[model samples]
Target: MPVLEVRRHTMRSKPGQHLSQQGVTLASLIGNSTGPFDLVWTSEKPRAIETAIAMGYTLTRQSAALGNLPKSILDAVAWPNDLESISKIVRRNNACERFARAQAEEWRSIAGELKDNQSALIVTHGAIIELGAIGFMPNATYSTWGDAIGYCEGFRFSQVEGLETCELLRVPSHLQLIHN
Candidate 1:
């Protein structure tokens, strides 16, 4: 099976467009332990691109779809929602479902293109990751997923027999601590 690991960009100051110095360090640490991915993708946002580079991966692609959700969608769903809430919204909202489906298709297409034993990495934003995961695995138990993803947190998705599976990916607790 081919795997796709999708993560939000590393830390950035609120209202800032670029990665913070600590974000660079955190991404470097993450790179050391994870992936020699076959392909890497990012959002068009500088923070996303910088996270991939800091993780030492060559950029394979960038898409704005991974960066920003539409204003209408943003207005419809509250920010920082857990998977369960997002799932409910997806089921009830046509626009949300459409966006989620598109995200899932992009992930599937990327994963499908890879050979067996190969994997891809996508560094994107929070809501995009959550919606894509829910869209890809609608039957998954969302209540177990806890809160929404934070910086550098996301999911690992893989396909088997035309069905998709998702696993939450979290940065190590040690790496999450702020240094004085």
Candidate 2:
């Protein structure tokens, strides 16, 4: 089944933010869903929670398994070159690596709980989404600390034995739009 990894829509609080468009798009997508959703999940943050509510899903328990991220240990994250550095960093921190490992394990367990073809929506922070997805992929490995994460970007994967490596399905819909 396809997981609609929606980046939560805009917050009225942050007037004129890029995320507003993402929020609008998410609203459009959810409004268009004709089938029943098995579950809806969201981050503790108000923006994410409000987006989930607007999308019309009743709340499931919030997940620390999907919470705001701790920064990675690697130096400045630049990708390509930084990817190797990040992987090296993950190889260094026993605790951070452990967290990543645990997260993947939990997602595997969570996938089993869902009914076959059951549609579930998880409204969460971008870091958690990246940690849950890229941190769990195959052929790719990383340091437990210092993973470069961007906002509102995430992935989708089919559950086989465990949560498979995911493709980045969405990104923060707006950032430049956010103003103090």
Candidate 3:
């Protein structure tokens, strides 16, 4: 079985939407700590591509399934309308949940297709990797995403065929403490 590691792209420059110092830090950390991967994938986004390259992946491929939730969906979440009727709210919420579940299933299918002894690395966004993939993670390892997945944070899964549960290898840690 191969292990699949999913990472969130680190901080990006806002104005130009490029990699930031925090992003560089994450790339350097991964390059120093992790072993060489058999396959590397990044979401079809510049920030994700930059993160993968900085992590020493010279031949990273783009996987749309590993990208962020759709912009319109994200916008809805970020700025939800409080004026919506009950039925409208229910429909919107259900739609978003369905989309997240689909994303998780897609990643699971991708993981199942990996050959033995092949480790796959993915660089993606927080919403997709954090919230979307939470339910797929081992219950013992991660009960919930719970805001632990900050910028560039991620988790690793031991991907075995027919396994509904996976072994969690790493839990993202804060590179710097947020509180005094």
Candidate 4:
């Protein structure tokens, strides 16, 4: 997720927020990559839907299953801010492990189904990129969970024998921070 557009939401949770300037920059940046996606999946959230549209994809399905990780457990427990701790394990489980498993399964099925040169794009949350990509590649690591992929950046994957491989991909510069 981009800095301004980054956050998590569950089904029926609405932020009532519109696109930020950073988000529009991302859309134009990501859109430049000609995506002839055969199918585009997105969360029902406006950010995800809009991100997909901004990137020039037509949404084929919007699913809650592909949305952000449920934050109920994290909300229930009062935890320290330190990420490198025993408490992080519990947070990681709730926010990452299980959701990653589910997403990896879905990714595997899609990877298996696609033909040569065919592609599917999933516009989803940061957790879906971090935990999910790491789930598929157990050795992957990052300075923090959220840092696994930046806002508007993600992993491209290919699966074989029920395992998927990931390659990090980022949105190109839209020149908002650059002087002309």
Candidate 5:
């Protein structure tokens, strides 16, 4: 099966648009164990692009659709909510739902382009990752998914019988740094 590993950008100092030095270190560590990915993608945001570079991958493409969401959609859902809360907003709010569907479709489109046994990596933001996962796997057990994804945390998606299945990806506890 083709695989897509989508992860949030690593840590950035507050009020900065780029990754911190420590973020580079963390991403490098994570990259060490990760892949020889067939393709790599990122949001156009500097932080997302930097994360992929730090993780030792070159950009295959960057998309505004992956990073930019309208202010209306941003206003409709609270930032930093848990998966279940975001999933609820996705169901009731038209803007959120539309954005979520777009995210899901983007993931599918990327995965569809991969050849058998190939894998891809996408580096994006927190809410985009969460919404995409929920959009792609609506019936998943959200409550067990805990809080919003942290830096370098996201999901791995694989298609089985034409349906997508997702699993959470997390920075190992030993590698997690305390953010001030």
Candidate 6:
């Protein structure tokens, strides 16, 4: 039982808000993820929207950066780069890196405003999760989707320096794999 859980929709042939067979798997995963969440944020892509719907969550808001992304780029990447892949792919021109940072910032800002009674669900890409996690584990970097999927990934942020805290839980056991 995690306080927060972020999942990448199983597999997508494209990058929009469309649902696949994975939706059922995702729904099951959400059911296992927890009883209910106070808020849910998702990217504006078809796949993401579909995933949110399948999971029985209402898509109240969308990340601008996510909506601006071109699906062609997402489809081209294999996801989860190893050392070799990192060597070949890491660069200043990496839009994914840029997007990831922006996404993380948004989530951080949103998390900061949370009240004690509120719990949130943020539906985003693997890269964003990696960027957010960077602050937690200085040495451990999320390099691929597989790494994200295998781990129940998320973060906890404390406001008032040490008093109030918001968490993002990534518990594998709580996730149910679904392909709509």
Best by TM-score: 5
Q: For each candidate, what TM-score against the reference?
A: 0.92, 0.59, 0.73, 0.67, 0.93, 0.59
C-alpha lDDT (0 to 100) for residue 110 of candidate 5: 87
Compared with the true structure, the alpha-carbon lDDT of candidate 2 equals 0.50
RMSD of each: 1.9, 6.2, 5.7, 6.9, 1.6, 5.7
Regarding lDDT, does 4 or 6 come out ahead?
Answer: 4
Model 4: how far is 49 from its true place, Å?
A: 0.7
Best by lDDT: 5
Worst 10 residues of 6 by lDDT: 144-153
- Predicted candidate 1 versus true structure: per-residue lDDT over 13-118, tens digit per residue: 6698888898888888888888999999898999999999998999999987788789888666576898899889999999999988998888877787799889
Off by over 4 Å in 3: 75-92, 138-145, 159-174, 177-180
Instruction: Extract clashing residue pairs from model 5.
Output: none
Per-candidate count of clashing residue pairs (backbone under 3 Å): 0, 14, 0, 2, 0, 24
Report the Cα lDDT for residue 151, model 6: 23
Misplaced by over 4 Å in model 4 are 1-15, 72-95, 139-146, 159-164, 172-180
Query: How displaced is residue 114 in candidate 3, in Å?
Result: 1.5
The lDDT, on a scale of 0 to 1, for candidate 1 is 0.85
Candidate 2 C-alpha lDDT tens digits along 1-180? 534343423344365322465565554454455335576666666666666666666777566555555565222222323334544445566655565566556565555567667756666654344444444663464343233343333345565665544444433344334311
lDDT of 5 at 36: 79
When 2 and 3 are scored with lDDT, the better candidate is 3
Error of 3 at 25 (Å): 2.5
